[model samples]
Target: MTAHAAGRYATALFELAKSSGAADAVEADLSAFRAMLDSSPELAGALASPLHAAEDKVSVLKALAEKAKFNELTLNTFGVAARNGRAGDLGKVASVYAALAAADRGVVTADVQTAAPLTKKQTEALAASLKGAFGREIEVRTDVRPELMGGLIVKVGSRMFDSSLRTKLDGMKTAMKEA
Candidate 1:
C-alpha cells in the first residue's frame, strides 16, 4: 500500500470509470468512501490493517458499499483492491482518482487559506485569477486560518503561493538567521 501503488490503482480506476462514462459518479463514491474512513477510526484502521482476511475485508466493503449505494465500478474497484491485498491504500487511490477525473474535465482545484472570511467578490476574483493562470476552470475552496495573520495562501495542484504575513515574517527570520 505504498503511495506509488495507490497512484497506479487510482489511475487504472480513473481510466475504467472514464471509459464506462461513470467518472463523476465514481469520484463522488470515492469521496464518500474517504469521508467514511475519516469519520470512523475503527473502520479506517480495519481497512488499512493487513491482519484482516481478504474475505472478511471484502464482506465489510460490500456491506458498506451497498449501504452507500456506490456505483458498480467503484465497488468493483474496491473489491479488486481487496483481492490484491492493497486495500490499505484505498483512500489514497480514491484521492488520486478524483484528482485525475477533475483534471480530465479541465478543472483545477484551488485551496485558499486566508486569515479571515472572503467576500463573494473576492472569491470570484481569486477563482478568475487562478483560471487565468492555469488556463482552466478553477474550483476554489476557501478555508480560514487565523494563524495566517493576514493575506492569503493559494495552492493549486502541487504548487503553493504563500502571501500570508506569518509566512513572510518566518521567511525573513530564517533569512536573518542564515545570514
Candidate 2:
C-alpha cells in the first residue's frame, strides 16, 4: 500500500482503539502482526496484493487472528480493514496506532543510538532529562551503534538531538571546508 493510505488506516485504527479502551491490547496485537509480516514473506505479499479478492483475504486474516489468539477488538479491526479493501495498510496502521496511544498517555518514546552500552544510571538520567524536556514520561529505547564513535543521538517524535562525536566532527569538517 502507499504510505499515505497506510497512514490514514493507522489514524482510523488509533481512534477506534482509543475509544474502545483497548489501545494497549490492540498495540500488542499489532506487534504480533508485525512479527508475522516479518517472518512470513508469503503472508506479507498476499496481504499487500491488490489482485486478491476481499472475501479470500478476509477469511485468511480471520484464520490468522484465531491462530494468534487476538482479542475481539483487534480481530474486528482487521475484518473491517479487509472488508474495506485496505488490508495492505494494516502494518502501518498498527504502528501509527501505537504511537498515538503512547502520546495520549503522556509518554514519549526516545530512540537512543549510542556508541556503547550505557550503564543503568546513565539510562535513568537520560530518561529523566527527556521527561523534563518533554514534560511527560519518557520511554527510552537504546541501540548500540559503533559508528557513532562516542556519545549518543536522541530522537523523540520529529525532533532529534545529535551529540554523537561522528556527527560533531562531520559538522566541523563541513564548516572548515566552507570557510
Candidate 3:
C-alpha cells in the first residue's frame, strides 16, 4: 500500500517534470533529498512522525527545499507529497522517480549494496559488466552496508543477486546444523 502511494506520487512528479523539461533536475534534487534523509535521522523522523501536522511538514519541507535551492518543480512536488501526508515515503518516491527517469532514457537501474564504498573505477566496471550481461544501459545506484562484511548485493528489477558475506556465513551455518 505504501509502495502504491509512492509510485503514484512519483509518477505524477515525473509527468510534471517531463512536461517542464526538468526531469533530470528533479531527479537530482530528490536524490539529494534522499541523501539528506539518510544522513539525518532527526529530519527523517520529523517527516515520518504522525505527530506533526501535514501543513507543518509542508512548511518544513518547503524551507529545506528553498535552502537547498532545488528546482521549482521538485519543491512543488515535495510540497504536494507533504500535503498528502506521504512525506515519509519521499525516499521511496525518489527511488521510483530515478527508475522512471532511467527508463525514459532506455536504461535499467541496478541497486548495488556493498560492505564498503566502491571507487569510481570499480563502479564503472560494475556498470559495464551489468550492461554487458543485461544487454542494456545500466544505471548503478550504490549504497554502503558494513554489516555485509564483504562482497556485494545487486538488484535489477525483480531479480536479486546476493553475494554478501553475511548471507554466505548464514548459509554455511544452516548447512552445518543440518549436517
Candidate 3 residue-pair clash tally: 0
TM-score of each candidate? 0.74, 0.66, 0.95
Alpha-carbon runs more than 4 Å astray in model 3: none
Give Cα-based local distance difference scores for all models.
Answer: 0.88, 0.85, 0.95
Models sorted by lDDT, best on top: 3, 1, 2
lDDT per residue for candidate 1 within 42-142, as digits (tens), equals: 99889878899987888899889999999999888889988888887898897788678778878888879999999999999999988989888997867
- lDDT, candidate 1, residue 58? 89
Between 1 and 2, whose lDDT is larger?
Answer: 1
Give per-candidate clash totals.
0, 1, 0
> Per-residue lDDT of 51-114 in model 2, one digit per residue for the tens?
8998888999999999999978888878888888888778777767667777787788887999
**Stretches of candidate 1 exceeding 4 Å from the true structure:** 111-125, 141-153, 163-179
Model 1 lDDT-worst window of ten? 94-103
Task: List the candidates ranked by TM-score, beginning with the highest.
Answer: 3, 1, 2
Query: Candidate 3 — worst ten consecutive residues by lDDT sum?
Result: 76-85
Greater-TM-score candidate between 1 and 2? 1
Query: Candidate 1, after superposition: displacement of residue 109 in Å?
Result: 2.7
